[model samples]
Structures are given as structure tokens and as C-alpha cells.
Target: MITPGSNITDRFAIVREDMHRRYGQYFYADTIDALLDEKIAQAKATAKIETFLPVTVEREVSSELEQRAEAAGRSGTARPEILFVCERNAGRSQLASAITHQAVGDRVFVRSVGLNPSGGIDPQVLEVLQERGVPTGHMYQKEIVPRTVHRASVVVLMGVDEVPGIPGDRVVRWDIADPAGQPIEKVREIADDVEAHVKNLLDELGKTNFNAA
Candidate 1:
């Protein structure tokens, strides 16, 4: 928890510098500052651990900036973006996202979020992914933000029925069990299922080059 007198400014400064370096060509300093401040406030409201608030805010800002750049045809690639959504974002969606990243590398851009994000990731989820040599360093629990949904080329739903405002054509539903509080064995099974689904999705994506419309 960040206290009133904590050095939040220092933490925010780091985010500001990094954002300016990456996105200054597209956004004004003041605009970035305002967006950064809004993200920080939102993070404080929803984040269970404040230790990585700055990093989370930076990610949110970067996502929005990337969307804006793409809209303006400034982003270099027309890569199809995939967003995985689930109830908590700790298990099912996370598994699918990590597996997709492992399978596709940078050929596709993938992200996962929860409807109501809470707690950290399930330990078993991390263990299973690590067992498969999948990278989990960048995986974090985050709530679904509006821009996130709007920017997705494909919104994959796992144990989630629907998300408001997304066009029906962009959504894909998966019937996967939640891995939270499950045993490692069960978690591994879930991981296997997620891996299979990811492989199929990749194949459907034709390895690369997709028309997301």
C-alpha cells in the first residue's frame, strides 16, 4: 500500500520518462501526463499489490498509445491483436495467453484481463507454465479496460459469457475450468487444454497474416 507521504512521484517519474521516450512522437507531453495520472489512479483503485503499480500503469498507457498509433497508421505492423478474458484472469486466461505467446512469439500480440481482477496469479498456474518453458515474467492480473476491448482483433472468452460493447463477430468463447485453488495435476491438465486451444487458434490464424475483420 502506498502511504500518503510515500515517494510516488519518483515512481511516476520513471513511467513518464519511459513513455515519453517510446510515445512522444505521437502524443504530447501533457496528454501523456494526464493519461498516466488517470491510469495511476485506476491502478490504485483496483490493484491488490501496489508494488507494481507503475509498471501496470505504463502497460495500460502503452496499450492505449499503441491503439492510437494503429488508428493513425503510425504503428509499424498490422498484427492481429488477441485478448483473452476470464473471470479472475489468474488461471484460464493466463494459461491461454502464456501458451499463445510461447507458440507464436511476436507473430501475434496477445493480452489477458479479468472481468473483476483480484489477488495475484495462482501459483499452480505459474508452475505449469514454467514446466513447459513458457515465459511468465510479463503476466500480471489486470481488469478489462475499455481501450483494451476496443483494440482487440479477437476477444477470446474463457468461462466468461460476454463483455459489453464488443462486436459479436470479434468474440470467441472457450469452455475451460477455472484453475484457482486447484491441485497442480489439475492445473497441468488445464494448461494442456489451453495449449491445444492456442495451437488451434494459431493454425486458424494461418501462422501469420490475418484479416481480423
Candidate 2:
């Protein structure tokens, strides 16, 4: 007797009554039934599905830095800050941080900080970046303060050691090499690693709606 336009709630009520009558004592009338009923109610409440969304802060920052560096080389201006991060702010973190800043011109900011920052910037890291025409300013080590995190709209983490206590929703990790006492070639490999990660991040950010206000 159900019509197409009949209320769903009324139809369900009728069905439940029929089930109870037919099954009698065999019907699930315990806590399991209650749980199933609750789940069903929740599903009915949220029947519509939502679409997936993506954000790429790290990628945009990397791209912006690269472009700025090229333009700055052509002209002669200071770049903006593009913060690079890792565990100790000495090896992988310092290298990635310096390269990113140098590759991007004065229009972009570039800085590197660490979670447990120790040791000065690695000399080998500095050399590779310099070869790529990226400048290495005074590379001191500092802990990642709240102000540092706030200053960066995009943050890149190079290794597990450098992993900060920041929210995962706002951080990007690139598992690169730790060029402590390794050869110069090994440091270059780490630079390549940083470059690849940065490019991927930029591509991802390009596809997102970052201007959502």
C-alpha cells in the first residue's frame, strides 16, 4: 500500500512493525538492535556526500622562491623570507633552507629554523647552494618558536629528526639526506632531493583554492 510520495519515516515504522510481528521472540531486541538503530539514524541524518579538497602551501612557497631568485639575479634586489625547517638546523635542514632562499629572489623571504636546532649551517650544503646561484646568508641555528611558525605561510620539513610539534595539517615533510660529514656529491644528492620535493609541493599548491576567505 506504499505510494512513491509516502513519508519514509512512516514506511520504516510499518516495516519495523511487520518485522516484530513476523519474528516475535527471534527479533533482535537487545543492545545490538539499539546500536544498529542509532547507526541507521546517523546515516539518514547525513545522506549527502561531500567532495574532497586539497591545499599546497609548501609547493607555492618553493615555486615563488625559485622565480624570485631568477628575477633577482636579472635585477639586483633582496628576496622575501621562505622558511626551511628540519630537526637540528645543521645539515639537511640548513641545505634545503639555503637553497630555497637563494633560488627565490628578494621578493620572497627565506629562513631556516629547526626543532632541536644545533650546530651552524653545514659547509657542504652551503657550497652546493652557492654553485646553484643561491646565496647563503648568515646561517645560525635557532629553535622553531611560535613566531617562526606564524611568520611562514608555508613550512617544509626535510627529515624525521627535524619534525616539529606543529599540526600535521599545516606541515610538509621531505625525507632527504643528512649531510653531516658525507662527501660533497652526497650533499648534492640531498639538494636534488630538496628540489624534487619543493617542485611537487608547488604543483600541488597550484591546484588548491588558497584564497578561500
Candidate 3:
């Protein structure tokens, strides 16, 4: 059973073995363990709840490593990147980002941020996501990087009035309710709305470019 209390070193070994099995090209014995440890420790330090903590750590750390591995193997290109922004950065922004990442994958570089960051991502949001099978491990962004606003091809505003001086053509705003402090059922309703918006955005993105990866 997955638990928050699983042995850390043992979990690291499991992640290493799986990384090798699935992505051995990305796994280097001398470096991968340390990288994984760094990521897991970071997650442990930031996570608000311990539920399925090890699973969350493994999924997120592996994705970060995978992106690095893939980037190291290829030339750079200016892919369409979507940046989701909100005040708290923990709930609505993250849920939108996560759905976008899953729905749109390598077709776009996806990120989310907050104006005033919250302590870790909201745990209730994570709980609602668990019910949707969307994997809530990677919404760990705690700060809104200014460069993210400049770098994005599209900026999505959630439950925020506005971001000053962002081009009108590049910004999209949704009127969905915030996910923080809402009951699980209400949050689930919000998740459904976010998923619908994600699907609409994906359609607007055109057909996926399999070659982008």
C-alpha cells in the first residue's frame, strides 16, 4: 500500500529501478539517485498532506527528469507555452495547469503561478484530483516567476481581476470559482469546469504535433 510513511531510501530505489526500466537512457547511476533524492526531499518539505506522498514524489520527480533528458537529446524550438496565473496559485491555477498538461502534453509547454503564493498546493484540490485519476503530484509551484508571464504564448487568468500590460490577444480569463476552502463536492464541480475549459483550449491548439516530443 502507498503510504506517507514509506521508507525514503527504499522509495528512492524503487523510483530508480522504474526509471531504468522505462527510461534507462535517462538513468545514470552516478547522478540519477541524487537528483531523485533532491526532488523527493523537496516534495516532502512542501506537501501539505502525506496521502500517497511517495507516489506523488515519484511521479513528479520522474517527469522533471524526463523533461531534462528529452531536452538534452534535442534542439530547441519555440513551442506554444501556456501559463496559468492566479492570486493563491494553489488551487484554480494549478488545476487548470494540470489539466492542460495532461490534455495537451508535449504539444505545449504548460506552467502555473500565483501572485501571492500559498503554502504548498491546497490538499483538498489534490483530493478532488485523486478522484478524477489526474495525478495531483506536480502542482508544487509556490511562486509566480515574472519571466513566466513574459515567456508564455498564452496567459490564463483564474479568479483574478487582471495582470497589468499583458497583451489582450495572448491572455484568456475564466470566471470559475476558486477551489480553496470549498467542500470536496463543490471542488469537484470546479474540476469538471476546468476540464471542460481545458478541452476547449486543446481544440483551439489544433491537432497535436507528435514530432514536437
Candidate 4:
């Protein structure tokens, strides 16, 4: 647990050691450390309970490293990567990524990012996602990172304009409404719309056995 005046250096060292052991072969030590700093900084900015910051940073770094490995064909079976992007990762992109994960599981790698990330997830969005049985444990508002863009097989953009890092062929726009401040009923409607798009995308990707209703 991080507290005011607590020596964060030790905690960060532990996280760095864990990551190095897991991804030392695939990525440079400098790269791992840089990402560790980035994740910690991001997590600290919005963490409700400072105690969970280390755990959150570790998980975020591991996810990024795993995606990097898969993108470079260094990991095991290469799963199709899907990245969902919106203005703020608090609503639409979160729904899309969570719904897609609930549908395909690990058979396809899923990520969500914002052009300009918000401080947290939307409460109404959380309610709708829980109603659909999608796990919200790993969900967070993340700013789009370069490597995350470069690795995606498909990038779904919603309510946002150009993503300068990714190729045109990989981008797909969804006209779904953003649920940031909408009523619960409207958020549900948006969730249904997101689910429909996710279903079709999984079908197109040949991962047709979707479990997301």
C-alpha cells in the first residue's frame, strides 16, 4: 500500500524485478523500466485506493508486455488483436473492449484506449456492463500508446477522429453513442449496439462462438 511519504522506490523495484523475470528475454530492461514508470504514473493519477496501485501497475505492464510479445511473434499462438479507441476511455471503448473480451475470451487479444483519457470509468457504464456479465476488474481508462496501436489487427474508433499512429486499413469506425453522462436506459441501448458490433466483428474474425449476449 502506498501512503504519503512512503518509499515508493522499493515497491517499484519489486514490480520491475517481477517484470524483468517475465519479459527480460523479449524486451530490454530500459523498455521495461520505462513502461513501469508510465503505468505507475497513470495508475497513481486516478487510483481510489492507493494500496492497489502496485497491483494495477503490475497487471498493466504484464498486459502490455504480453501484447508486445504476441505482436512480435515471440509469444505462443498469435491471437488476433483488437483495440477500441474513443475520446475518453471511460465509456464507449471500455464497453466495446469488455464486451469483446466476454465474447471471445483470450482467443483474441483486446485493448481499450482513449485519445484523451478520463479519470475513471462511468458508473452507468459499469452498471450496464455488469448486467451483461462482463468482468470489469481489468477495465480502466487508458490513453492510447504507440505500441498498442502498432500491434492491433483491428482498431475500432468511436466518437473520435483520426488515430495518427495506426494504418488506415486497420481502423474501423462505430457510430455508437457515448455513454459518459447518459441515463441508464440509454447506456443499455448503447451497450446493445456495442454487443451487436462485437458479435459481427468476432464472426468476421472467425471467432464465431461468442458468449456475450
* Model 1 per-residue lDDT tens digits across residues 156-212: 988876564543347788888899888899998888788777777777777743222
lDDT of each: 0.75, 0.54, 0.69, 0.80
lDDT of 3 by residue, 77-130 (tens): 445667788888889988887777666554566777788885878888888777
For candidate 4, list the clashing residue pairs, or say none. none
What count of clashes does model 4 give? 0
Better of 1 and 3 by lDDT: 1
**Candidate 4, lDDT over the whole model:** 0.80
| Superior candidate under TM-score, 2 versus 3 | 3
| lDDT value, candidate 3, whole model | 0.69
Better of 1 and 4 by lDDT: 4
Evaluation by lDDT, superior candidate among 2 and 4: 4
Candidate 4 residue-wise lDDT, 41-66, digit = tens: 88888877776677678888999899
In model 1, where is the ten-residue run with the lowest total lDDT? 1-10
TM-score of each: 0.62, 0.51, 0.59, 0.64
For model 2 the TM-score comes to 0.51
Better candidate by lDDT, 2 or 3: 3
Error of 1 at 135 (Å): 1.2
